[model samples]
Target: MNPVIPRLARLFLIAFAGVVALIVVVQIVWINPGKRCEEAGNWWDWRGRACARPVLISDITGRVIDTPEARAAAKDHAASQKAAASKAAPEAVKP
Candidate 1:
């Protein structure tokens, strides 16, 4: 019955428990969300911890799926919104 051996064994058990707890936390917090996101066919933003739909560009035959006209319309709409915001910003700054 060596006292030093028991102390070393206790330290090893504590270290082992800490490692297991850390692994469980990592699996729950970091790994599971990314796995779920992939299974749902969405892009995972790791830094933001959010899932986003991927943009489809074209089909296998080179036919464009995301049409140019649709893009232009979106651009025009964005420009209009930006202009409106800018106009409101000046009014908001007035005393």
Candidate 2:
């Protein structure tokens, strides 16, 4: 009975080590996706290409409605949203 316990423990340890080694090997070989897509300022498509979100399809298409004025308006709207958020949550700074 005493010898059986040690043999079982040894088998369990070997199996655990094998699993750990497999995990390390997989991590070394893993290729991270979406780095190129981030650089291109778009989402990573399945074909490894950068693609605009469906909601922004019209903007990407350069439609007549998407003019410089519209872009400026969008920028101004974003700035106002940020300002409002900051005002709502004033951070407490310790100097």
Candidate 3:
């Protein structure tokens, strides 16, 4: 029986186990939480390790879109932008 062969085999097994443990820890601590946050319709703040509401936007307009009225306005603004884009697309395709 060769002693050197057994020692090398043991070292390889230890290194492989360490790598697997590291992967499991990362999945539990970081990956899973971020996925759950997004699935719940919230933003995952990686630096803060917390979930937050997403910021609403209405094209290039700088108005705050937080209230019910503002949200309705944002929805209208988005529809108008979509209509404008569709109208412009046909003009650009003319030969």
TM per candidate comes to: 0.52, 0.38, 0.56
Sequence-dependent TM-score of model 2: 0.38
Best by TM-score: 3
lDDT of 2 by residue, 56-90 (tens): 54567776545889989878987999898888675
Q: Where does candidate 1 have its weakest 10-residue lDDT segment?
A: 56-65
- Over 3-68, each residue of candidate 3 has an lDDT whose tens digit, in order, gives 999999999999999999999998988889999999999999887789898665544468656699
| Clashes by residue pair, model 1 | none
TM-score, prediction 3: 0.56
Best by lDDT: 3
Q: By lDDT, is 1 or 2 better?
A: 1
Ordered list by TM-score, greatest first: 3, 1, 2
Per-candidate clashes come to 0, 0, 0
Superposed on all Cα atoms, the candidates' RMSDs to the truth, in angstroms, are 10.6, 7.6, 8.7
Q: In model 1, which regions exceed 4 Å deviation? A: 55-95
Q: Say which prediction, candidate 1 or candidate 2, comes out ahead on TM-score.
A: 1
